[model samples]
Target: MSHHIVLRVVAKLLIPLILLFALYVQFHGDFGPGGGFQAGVIFAAALILYALVFGLDSARRVISPDLLRVLMASGVLLYGGVGVASLLLGGHFLDYSVLASDPVAGQHLGILLVELGVGITVTSTMLSLFYGFAGRGGDG
Candidate 1:
């Protein structure tokens, strides 16, 4: 890859665009077809592509495994915390209507937060899997 100048250049150019598109999918999910799962996969794909082009070690440096683990747990906590908050607000678990004074606003905010959590978890999990497979040392 170090010798593949053209490939390197192209990857550098495309990675940012890929990241931007993933963000678009994440934020626009509330109104359109894309959502947390789709955005998460897309985001992971970009990092994987970077790994493929730049090398796994480089990708690891970009995002450490420890950080990924933290992110994985944090995402779940965020999702669960939202549910708990709703419960404490005198609503059933995951009842977004009680998340805020305005039902519509609460719905919007709740969905956005839940989707964000999903996106974070999926992205980290996918990256962790990629790192595991790529880090393996064996002759096949």
Candidate 2:
């Protein structure tokens, strides 16, 4: 991989674009088709490309397994927290109508938060999977 200078350069150029596109998908999801799952996969793909071009060790340094674990837990907490908050606000679980004074605004906010949590969880999970499998360093 180190010898493939052209490949490396192309990857360097492409990774940021991939990441930006993932962000676009993530943010525009509520209004359009793309969303957390798609964005997460796209984000992971960029990092996977980085790992393939740079090395697993480099990718690990960029996002350690310990951090990934924390992110996984945090994402779940975020998703669940929204539900609990809505409940505490006198609405049923996941009732976004109570999330804000304006129901429409609350709906938007809830969707945004829920989607963000999903994105975080999925991205970290996928990265963890890649690290676990790729780090094995065996053909099996």
Candidate 3:
């Protein structure tokens, strides 16, 4: 990969667009054809493409394993926190209606937060898995 000049150049141009598209999928999911799962996979795939082109060390440096672990935990907490918030507001578990004074507003807010959490967790988990597997391969 280090020697693949064309690949390196193309990757440099494409990676940002890939990341941007992942973000678009994540945010637009509420209204359209994508969601946390799809967005997360795309996000992880972009990072992986970076790893494949620039080396795992570079990718790890860009997004550390330690940070990934923290993100994984935080994402779960974020999702759970939304549920707890709803409960505190006198709603049922995982209920979004009480999150805001207006039920519709609350539902929208809760769904967005929940989806963001899912996206983070999925992306981190996939990337972590990729790193684990990549680490086990030959030193070639």
Please, what is the whole-model Cα lDDT of each candidate in the order they appear? 0.93, 0.92, 0.92
Model 1 spans > 4 angstroms off: 138-140
Global fold similarity of model 1 (TM-score): 0.96
lDDT against true structure, model 1? 0.93
Model 1 root-mean-square deviation = 1.6
How many clashes does each candidate structure show, in the order listed? 0, 0, 0
TM-score, cand. 2: 0.96
Error of 3 at 50 (Å): 0.2
What RMSD, rounded to one decimal, does every model reach? 1.6, 1.5, 1.1
Off by over 4 Å in 2: 138-140
Give the alpha carbon lDDT tens digit for every residue of 69-113 in model 3: 999899899999999988888999889999888999989999899
Weakest ten-residue segment in model 2 by summed lDDT:
131-140
Model 1 misses residue 44 by how many Å? 0.4
lDDT of 1 by residue, 27-48 (tens): 9998889998899999999999
Compared to the true structure, candidate 3 yields what TM-score? Answer: 0.96
Q: What tens digits encode model 2's per-residue C-alpha lDDT throughout 10-126?
A: 999999999999999999998889998899899999999999999888888999999999998888899999999999999999999999999999999999999888999999999
**Pairs that clash in candidate 1:** none
